[model samples]
Target: MSELLKTLLVDQLNVEVYQNRKVLGQVAAKSVALKMKEILKDKDRVRMIFAAAPSQNEFLEALTKEEGIDWSKVTAFHMDEYIGLQASAPQRFSHYLKERLFDIVNPGEVYLIDCENTIGDECRRYANLLTQEPIDIVCFGIGENGHIAFNDPPVADFQDPAIIKSVELDLVCQQQQVNDGCFTDIESVPTHALTLTIPTLISASYLFCMVPGTTKRDAVQKTLCGPISTKCPATILRRHENCTLYTDIDSCGAVEER
Candidate 1:
């Protein structure tokens, strides 16, 4: 078990800081696996939303290796996808999740966000799929600018009426993609993406947020210490009754210093 470096309650957000990214991922994965088992015990299936980014690499890798949970009873959905990226674009969130997770665990239903059709049609279709049943869990990470999914500060809506929608990418968000090596440069990154809104994401019964690395230190600090507003979009996690924020030494550095 990874040693817990610190624990804090930022409003309702349960924050846990670990020694390092690897240990943060392992401990978060183990806890999420246990939640999967508990939910599957009384339910026919488990539905989960996932975020795809290099920040999620450790958690997804660790989760897939966990034993005992019946993956066949789990349905998966990714939180966001680039709207104009080529089908072959390596930066596509769907492809990222496929390579790191879906292909590894082979969930019973893997619903990826596709842009082959009109973005509107795709958004409606995905929203329908998501609302057909309740979401058991949401496993995700924050951006360098504190966006959750693709709900950047400029576009995030806490009470958004749409379950999903296309949003223009914030410049900081685009640069973070470059920083994470998902894009060669900011100019090469997609300008828009399809993302589930804050309401849809927080509707899940359980939320396990894994944020690691030095790049996210500022965002993590804002999420935990800043006002609860879309200005730091991810600060809304504080209002989610069952959400847990998992961080590593590097990501939580700002909090430690303060």
Candidate 2:
């Protein structure tokens, strides 16, 4: 029942793969906890990056509950946020991270892109902060549109000059947020967003991407099989030396034939 199309490379990045979504999420969470423990051995401080999305709800929940992770030595960062939204806004990435991971764990430093600040200045400041630290691991999600962060299809560049910058949300990207129930409707979602570009996202020592659900099959295919281009932002993972993609049977359907 498989083999209709050529296998995509990104689909094969997993150091380990699982047949069950729940088990996949659990193994990924444990793998990250273990990886961080190993990386922190040689470094005094470790930085971690996280992304916010419905696809990550289970993964983040599992990761936050992971036993034995040294949260005290870790500094945290997130991938993106809506440009005009307040940090206190229900839709803000900062709030999502704080509730889902940071507040639950006492990290050494937790940096969030201040969406209320001037976009350009805030972008540069965040970029400088990111440059000062060597990221140990990055946990992220692929948008149903294949965006890595807010790096929507058109503006997601592999060589973005700034670590964080504003991007106009493509319809598919915006719709995915709503489809995932992050927003009540498309009209309620902010059209502009501040996002960590591809270069910075791919800069981490290890990257763990959590993707699940049949809604993501097309995107999973594009990201894994399509050419490594900005057209499908997440495709850049194909070049990373250490990247793990966690997905269930449904999301894995596109590449199952491989």
Candidate 3:
């Protein structure tokens, strides 16, 4: 195991800095696996939400390789999906998760956001499924603009009444899809997506946020130092009692240590 560069608490949140993305993923995956095992001891099923993106690749890879996780007892959900993408498109968040983790582990159930269907109906369907049980864990990544899921600053609502809804992507958020190589150009990215609202994501029993790379430096800084507002949606992490932010040295740049 690589040494953690720093460990600190920001209000109720726990933050850990690692040497690089690889080590960060390893440690984060270990923690997630352990938490799942702990939860399974007293619960019949563990419900988890995952983020699908290149930023989550490392952690998801490591997580699938963890030993002794009874994936058959786990039900999986994804945080968001591009509204108009074809189901078979490689850019589809469902496809991304299937290729990376779902197929590999074969969870007991996987409730994917059906972006090809009517957006409103899909939102209600998924929202109902999410509310069926309390979320045991949420493994997610912070966007370059500090958005969580597709909750871009313009659409983020800390007190949103709906659990899931369609949202227009901000320019910066669309550009990030290109930067992450998910799209060839900004024009190729979907303008809207169905996403779990801020309130929905923060409702999880535990949140493990994996953010890496220098491109995320500014967002990471704002997430840790800025006021808890919709401007940087990830700032809500500060309020979650069991949330942990795992970052590498590159992403933590310019943020003062406690």
Candidate 4:
């Protein structure tokens, strides 16, 4: 909340640039926590979908430090997961989320993709849970390939009918795993993943997209400037009514230079 470097609008998406990821995270956490409280004022529970990646660390940590939000009344779900990692693998998206966020605040219910299950069964199961009730909030990040969740350009569908489906990782998306230090190399990253489709993620009432670091500069620029197309899948956010994009000076640098 310190003097924001800049704030602008791209269609329906609101972009706010902060001094660094730390401030970006703190501000996003506060805004999300406040929205959660507002939703809980009338509903007994809030269903939130969260993304798993190092980019989410600061915000997740700051959100745990937030006060007045009844974490026990929140139902948590992650947006995607790799198919091959062992259940105990630290690199697994589910494991990453549990260690950082879920185990800390302990949402009342937590739903995650099961890598052990057949891709078909798991997708159907998670899709059911997702549609059981309307999603209140989605906290996510855009990939270096401009992906949302694991909805990489090659497999992304702007109007996907299936709520969840299996997707082959695009080369760029696979390399991003190594770049983020989630995987030691491209081959170690799973070729396929189960992700909530674009329609599913965009269905949420509110969306908070945290994108930071210098590596994300081009993706951020495409997300804000390109035509709304699957070529830059995250560009779909521009059509969302209540989505906010939080960026640090590093990630916002390209747009600033424009």
Q: Can you give the TM-score per candidate against the true fold?
A: 0.97, 0.92, 0.98, 0.98
Writing each residue's lDDT as its tens digit, candidate 4 over 155-208 gives: 899989999999899999999999999889998999988899999999999999
Per-residue CA lDDT of model 2 for 1-258, tens digit only, reads 121222234444653345656776777788898998888788887888998887777778898898887888998889898987765788888888888888888788888888777887898889888989778799988888888998888897888877788889999988888898889999889999888888888889999998888898898888767888888888888789899777777787737433
Which ten contiguous residues of candidate 4 have the minimum total lDDT? 249-258
The residue pairs that clash in candidate 4, if any, are: none
Clashes of each: 0, 1, 0, 0
Model 3, C-alpha of 64: deviation from truth (Å): 0.9
lDDT of all the models against the reference? 0.92, 0.81, 0.93, 0.93
**lDDT of candidate 1 vs native?**
0.92
> Which of the numbered candidates is closest to the native, going by highest TM-score?
3
Q: Determine which window of 10 residues in candidate 2 has minimal summed lDDT.
A: 1-10
Say which prediction, candidate 2 or candidate 3, comes out ahead on lDDT: 3
Off by over 4 Å in 3: none
Look at candidate 1 and tell me the lDDT of residue 95: 89
How many steric clashes does model 1 contain? 0
Q: What's the lDDT for residue 208 in model 4?
A: 99
Q: Please report, as a residue range, the 10-residue window in candidate 1 with the lowest summed lDDT.
A: 249-258
Candidate 1 versus the native: TM-score? 0.97
Q: Which segments of model 4 are wrong by more than 4 Å?
A: 256-258
Ranking, TM-score, top scorer first: 3, 4, 1, 2
Pairs with backbone N, CA or C atoms under 3 Å apart (clashes), candidate 3: none
